[model samples]
Target: MPRTERPRAPARAWFTGPGFAPAPDPAADPAGPRLVCFGYAGGTPSVFRDWADGVGPGVTVVPVLLPGRGLRSEEAPYTEMAELARDATEALVAAGHAAPGARHVFFGHSMGALLAYEVACALRDRGLSGPRHLFVSGSRAPHLYGGPDGQDLGDDALRQLVRDLGALRPDDRVGSAYLERRLPVLRADLALCARYRWRPRRPLGCPMTAFSADRDPIALPAQVEAWRAYTAASLLHRRVRGGHFFLHGPARLPLLRELRAELTRTAEEREPSWTH
Candidate 1:
């Protein structure tokens, strides 16, 4: 009989188990903060690959690969908010190592924003370090989404939903194929988003940056302002000149710049005269 070998683990799944993974720590950074970047709906971690480059040399960008997509395709997508937050918090704790002495930030767009915020609460609940800063883009406050009660819109209506937000086309051949294969995961994620219910808890102690597009139908000014109620720390609002998926191309530069500045400011506040 021939010998059988164990299957190899994928690259992205590295250090994603129980203990915190020892990546770079932001609090130790004399330059800036460590940042974990989250993606939009039906999207994966590849979205922020170039963020560190664009954000300049001070920040370190870590893209989160949600299960059921990217290298974790074999894993099942989470459908409930509690489960999703728990799973994400575990991986983030394992990956970021933002404990003991590290300070960190969360930068999430659309669905990713909600996931990051919830994970912060879950981290606090688990007696772990929560994100010190949160940058939410293209999403309203958690309570505004309410529930998935109206999620059963027609296909045409759904197309309009995507179009209205000007997201990446899920129909463009290769893109469509990827989306088709990944639709189950995406739908599960959307379901999680739909079912999420917000509890009126105490505000987050971290500073928050609410960023959005000037033309985004999904994010109104009022919706963006609701983010202010979630944090006792400084809350800043900045508007860009694009649609919901603005972070995909050159438009991402400004967003990255702002992130770098914030992280730099945070690092400076924690440890002054590092530049001197």
Candidate 2:
């Protein structure tokens, strides 16, 4: 899909479609980077909806609402990683072209981080220009070794994992509706996670920044560090307070500040190559 293609919108797109809504002049914000922030399996664009404003101008954060959530409620969530990546790449191209000249970035958390990484590489393979920086939060490296088999996870096991990871609990009072909607999405997301198999490949050339929690059980430092094997891009990792979803926690300010600095550096590095 082109940047101008309408995203399968949940609501009758007042603007046209998901990715093309409120199209901006990608050229005007040459330094004004266009971010396609993906969410964890069950997550939504609302997670980083204000990320652009918070990160400051010159950077426009566009949280990607994967199908089955937000406005595209009718669509089913993508199961295959490559398939999701293709859809994401198309959406990104749409975002970039619809916006022109806007530098691009891919940001994802957990499963989303994985999605972002895969999509970034896919864009690279397709010879399409991609983000200046790859900001991955709360995830393990693709090449990192070891883990229990996540694929055989039954609903009993799946639900336990979610709650154990503190993502959700069906029994937890309140937010049941929220939990009801998100948990299935999370389960489907985990299915992708469990089935994902990484083969040895060349590392991505873009600079990579990873965010982790001091208490993150799913992604430990070693796993996070393993990301180095897959990235020719300089790898930097930051550990903050919070279990899994630290991005929403208090550490966001310092985190956002660092993100701003890196994004600025990346844009400047690419600036000289620009014709306009």
Q: Model 2, 34-134: lDDT tens per residue?
A: 66677876776676756766778666566666777766666676656767777766766654532334466677888888888888787778887766778
Deviation (Å) of 228 in candidate 1: 0.3
RMSD of candidates 1 onward, in order? 7.0, 6.0
Which residue pairs in candidate 2 collide? 3-94, 7-18, 10-71, 26-99, 26-100, 27-100, 29-32, 32-58, 104-131
**C-alpha local distance difference test of each model:** 0.70, 0.67
* 206-230: candidate 1 lDDT, tens digit per residue: 8788987877777776898799899
Q: What is the lDDT of residue 183 in candidate 2?
A: 62
Cα shift from native, residue 188, model 2 (Å): 1.0
- Clashes in candidate 1: how many? 1
